[model samples]
Target chain A: MTQAVATNDRATTFDVAAVRADFPILARNVHKKPLVYLDNAASSQKPRQVIEAVDQYYRRHNANVHRGLHTLSDEATAAYEAAREKVRGFINAAEIAEVIFTKGTTEAINLVAASYGRAHLSAGDEVLITYMEHHSNIVPWQMICEQTGAVLRVCPINERGELLLDAFEKLLSDKTRVVAFNHISNALGTVNPVKKMVKMAHAVGAVTVVDGAQAVPHQRIDVRDLDCDFYAFSGHKMFAPTGIGILYGKRYLLEQMPPYQGGGDMIKTVSFEKTVYNELPSKFEAGTPIIAGAVGLGAAVDYLERVGLDAVSAYEHSLLEYGDQRLKSVPGLRMIGDAVDKTSVFSFVMEGAHPHDIGTILSHTGVAVRTGHHCTEPLMKFFKVPGTVRASLAFYNTREEIDQLVDGLAKVREMLL
Target chain B: MNAAAPDLQDLYRRTIKGQAALFSQRRPPAIVTHRCEGSNPNCGDHLALALHLEDVAIAALGFEGESCLICRASAVMMADTLAGATVAQAHEFSRRLDAFLHDGQPLPGPLATTRCLEGVRAYPSRLSCALLPWQTLTRCIQPDPTYATTHLEAKP
Candidate 1:
């Protein structure tokens, strides 16, 4: 942060050092050098609050949820359901019943594709997705389409990795039954205009499914304002425990869709001849559920709110600008994504060095960067490169770490070139 | 069980870089008796091994790919060591290399630049990159041409 004109005084005074202290892993040293973690997009490091919350749960409140009349079971069930309520408020969902926990974003999307798409989609219908979608977003639609005889259409993006809105609009038709797209691309940090896209999808009588896995950490999410039918995000990427995610759906649509899985938790009554399903959220939640994960996610929501997402966004936006200028200083480095509204991702490819080799050299310097297509093979194919070296930033990431990354890139040039 | 990460200098030695760069300079064989594509989907490493087998020995060996330095270097070293070697000897080398990488067995005698890749064993992740081409070599020497992928152990 050599220079940053903060939008507000609160934004100006983002104590990154204090924020860094909350994450215990920040003190680590990798390969004899201080750690410079830039792989935030893959998975974020958990804070002490989140860790302690999970610890306290297992230590004190360990029991199966949503069943039993014992005190421990009641406390566990109340804590689990309270986590759902916390999520409902965190994403600004219309109702607590709209939140359904899954293994992660992948399972969240699969629930929509399998339960909703399998029932609503049919042969001769079309499902439109963007080329920049992660495999989680693309593969589920592909499988659902293949099973239902529906057509899968991919909307193209420009060279700078921004969505081609004109092309996206042209691709949307009345036959578009489902529209799936990511809120923010993980590989490239290009932020899609989901509000406008969701409106466009509504105009065509299609449902909007947003992959908000990368968005939830960087910015505040208002599912009610986005008005998307389904929004899926993973807790692990947002500084929570793994195997817990939120799928926020409209209540009416969730009522229409069938149960995603069948087990004790999802059923109201069971019979050999016929079985009735439970209400809104539990119908989709089929198993005993990731209770500890949900508890950790709840505490994570508390942590994010206490930190204030607005200040975090502003701080990261400045870091993004700083990183853009700093990484461009490295010779032979070409940035892969240069979207205007993007935040917290720096993807680039250096000449004469493969991404993995760059990654290896960077790792030695304790600058952990991700190399490869990042599960977005189509995006890599579109960029006409094998893969890009992605150094995704977070709110806790400082400009000094960006300098470390640049120095590591210089080391890469020295050795690999 | 490498307790410490491999040093960068030890991992990306001049031998590895020179072999990888030399592969870039040389072109794959125009025609070959056996050719197979090797792929590592985890890191998007794709390599092709083209060989000309005569009777039982490999007459010529060539490669083409944009894989990482470790992978390309390993592929070139395999080609250089196996040229004019019998198919059975190639299989033996492949087995020895796999065992060396996975089980820390000793590298067989008379290897030129292959010993430079010993640093890869410390990097459990990059071990797949070093083995991608050898795995492709194993599949290429077979009677059937199958697409090869990087794995520590050969599939039965």
Candidate 2:
């Protein structure tokens, strides 16, 4: 394949079909038509490498770790630990111990809320979150505050769906113990200015926790560089299995927090008298871990590494631009979250039709898109509509898919109007 | 050319015409200014059903929202069928409609007009899209005093 030299901020042009070929599911048909999987923000399609990695783990290294003494056991333990290192490097965490595996971002947030919020927060202390947060990010803080008598405060977002940074700064105070926000909005795809937010939160001695579920898969993340106390993300959104996710905390902070779950693997010793929790990451990871999921995530990371994140980001941005142009051409279509810096998720409402109708019509054409509040109900309420049809793209997606979507939308206009 | 031919079968199919005929003038009591809102949280098909009930029978039923063809058509079918029927009859019709959409069995006799929704049998997820309005109507009639208190409680 001929490679065009990169100039400016754009990626050097490459063979798009070759990239699409790596994902096997993309070849499958839905409703007797080619599958144009655009719901990447919900979950991504797995490459053969990630799928095979999980298969290889079950086929070859099928033994449990930490408790076994045999050779297979040793191999399993080493592979599992290696996956942790992969996760550590993926987000640029300071140490592997700081990267704790959870079921997904939702569980990770709950863990922090139950553990840190229970231990550190008290009455009159405030937990600050933004209006743009997903239900996962918002509810956990609300739960924690409800239990602790701590007040929950919100930083509002402007009409563009961008967080009001000045309002956020104004809300910060000595009583603000924590600031939890999504790094990128799953519904709107607006990439929040998280690093700056984290820095500001730190200035007030408030711990910052980022919901990186949408951010990590699309963009390069440097936890150390971002300097957030805690970050949470799901592996499924990053092309891994659904159950596996990572929660990265600062080393010192992770060490201080209590164990989230009381079960096997999290305890060093459990006696009738008292129990001693395991150190660092193990303390957070309770019960039998998602061994196969970790292996799958490691494989996904390996695949992304080989393709190069910069290349993937550039290709996705091009697809986003193409989608924006194509979708804009459709009459009576209004785009939501038209931020200057955004991810490849498009949230829009047709002028006369509801998002549900638009999504249904699109599905008939074999173009799958998410339509509704996108689990950000409060954000939906803020926008004063039930929901919008979201067509989220990934690196493997092409401009042709966007054209199909636009065409499908036009057909919907023809039928509905 | 022949009045008998056009009268033998209305402009549309017998089923469509029958459904349309059954939908004639039955405005609901209190006009149920607010319709039942139902959403399939998984795939995002949301709809609201407004109704006007007259005693035990439905007087007028209309829907204002959007969804897939199956859903929209189902909404139209639901409003048409339930408009002149009692609450219990509406419930039974919804149950049969649900089964039919799920590819279980066809509705018998004139009520078989629901066959139009068979187009959605292949798309199971869209079944919820189609049934959302009906489900919301059921919620409205289920006799919960709290239903009047919360405007958005029926959403699922």
Candidate 3:
């Protein structure tokens, strides 16, 4: 474990007030109190740079890409492809062709399930996933298994929300076709050991697909270093516009699989007899892509790069540690997932209070959080609780905000109990 | 028998105190015996509601489970409110309580004693929490041989 000194040295320092200035919505008050937005796991607040990028694209170069040979189209195509290159560099992928854009992580996972899973999976083959997976990751494999007669195998997590690595390794066999799991759980905030999981999956001749929706926004991701066959994350989770995401697939696997959608941009030539598909990325990116969303995502990537991922991760880690200790001091309040290697997500249930009631009371104090099963019903069932209140943090969040949240939860305890 | 009973707010104060006193006095059994199980599987709140009925009135009511405070508090409130009320009155009280919580309407004057639940108006999701015990009691007091003798599961 790295000492606090080393971690502190590596951490990036940011002017929170200036950072908050970049996000216009954070300035507004909710319920007559300054909004303390803590639902970053659901979606992050976009900075001014990303907002301006979307606005600029719409105002200046709002033409369709890949079709028009005109100047506007050329600019749009170049800008859109430039966003792709940014993503390629962001994840340190070997080539630009390996990055395919989709609506979001949900679509990316479905693409893999439909294209890759449908083609390669057969009866008696297994799709391995962890219990901590969000419904997006779990349901796709279930649907694929229903279609292909492949069985879905779940690797369980302990009470602490940490994945049982030994159990996961034991579940792998020659029949395993793919292992799809979240890099960080949206509900529990448990950062799974993906690099080790990928290595184990590879040893058993199975490909790994990581749902990076919760990971990409908080930490540095290198797809090449992860050695994963597929990595999917939503732009919205990374402070970009909604309805746009990136899917990083290994070049060989992506080239081998059929295109996810058949449309204008994905085709080489269309005729009555037959139509051939386009090249690597364009083949997967079917229609007129999310131009504004892509530009916004690129701007978000730039903002994160300027802040430095290592710094962002370190700041969040310290916040989580402080939050954990503070929240623990609240009587009858228990955190749901207490994973040692967790990110700054606090999911907890008050001993005598419903999560919804606690969330409502907290909202009155201008603290916004997600309260429910968080789309992990199996995990909730394992814990034997209805749901938990999830307070997720980002780089812009501060220690004072955590103090406010703790104070708010203390008030909730008084009101309810 | 009724003199426009007391102010509803005063009734609520008394009910809260009465419930607190009753919970403190008996410390109701942690595990219910002669149990009738009711569960809202969707939210994972499971309970065993036990009632002692005599002379067409609820002599006592006790419940055991690990549920949200709303449900548990509502259970304690029910035990305090229904102790002397006839089975018919208990059924009527449950309906009015449900309407007040779910529909956001004021409780009728005769049944306004349960108005401490008004706090629940702000927290809509906990409306189910405040009504679970009452719903269980309604079924517990039904006269039909199967409905009375047999426990039933209520789906949310």
| TM-score leader | 1
Residue A388 Cα positional deviation in candidate 3, in Å, after optimal superposition: 1.0
Candidate ordering by DockQ (highest first): 1, 2, 3
Write model 1 residue lDDT over B1-156, tens digit each, in one string.
324555667567657888887776545766588888988876889987788888998888888877999988888888788878998898899888878887878888846468788777766778889888888988887888688877433210
By TM-score, the better pick of 1 and 2 is 1
Best by lDDT: 1
Candidate 3: which stretches are off by over 4 Å?
A1-12, B1-156
Per-residue alpha-carbon lDDT of candidate 1 for residues A98-210, written as tens digits (9 for 90 to 100)? 99999999999999999999999999999999999999999899999999999999999998899999999999999999999999999999999999999999999999999
Compared with the true structure, model 1 gives a TM-score of 0.96
What's the best-to-worst order under TM-score?
1, 2, 3
lDDT of 3 at A192: 91
User: Residue-wise lDDT of candidate 2 within A1-417, one digit each (tens)?
Assistant: 333434356547756677678789999876667999988888999998999999999999978878789988888888888999998999999889999999999999999999999999999999999988888998899999999999999999888899988999999999999999999999899999889999999999999999999987788899999999999999999999999999999988888788889988899999999999998888988887999899999998888787778777777777778789889889999888888889899999888676766776677677989877888888887887778899999888877789999999888777656
Q: Put down candidate 3 lDDT per residue, A1-417, tens digits, no spaces.
A: 122312554543455666677788888886667889998998899998999999999899989999999999999999999999999999999999999999999899999999999999999999999999888898889999999999999998898999999999999999999999999999889999889999999999999999999999899999989999999999999999998999999999998999888889999999999999999899999888998899999999999998788867776887888889898998998888889899989999988677766776787788988876777878888998888889999877878888889989887766656
| Top-DockQ candidate index | 1
Candidate 1 vs candidate 3, lDDT winner: 1
Q: For model 3, what is the error of residue A375's alpha carbon versus the real structure, in angstroms, after optimal superposition?
A: 0.5
Select the stronger candidate by TM-score from 2 and 3: 2
Scanning candidate 2 chain A in windows of ten residues, the lowest lDDT window is A1-10
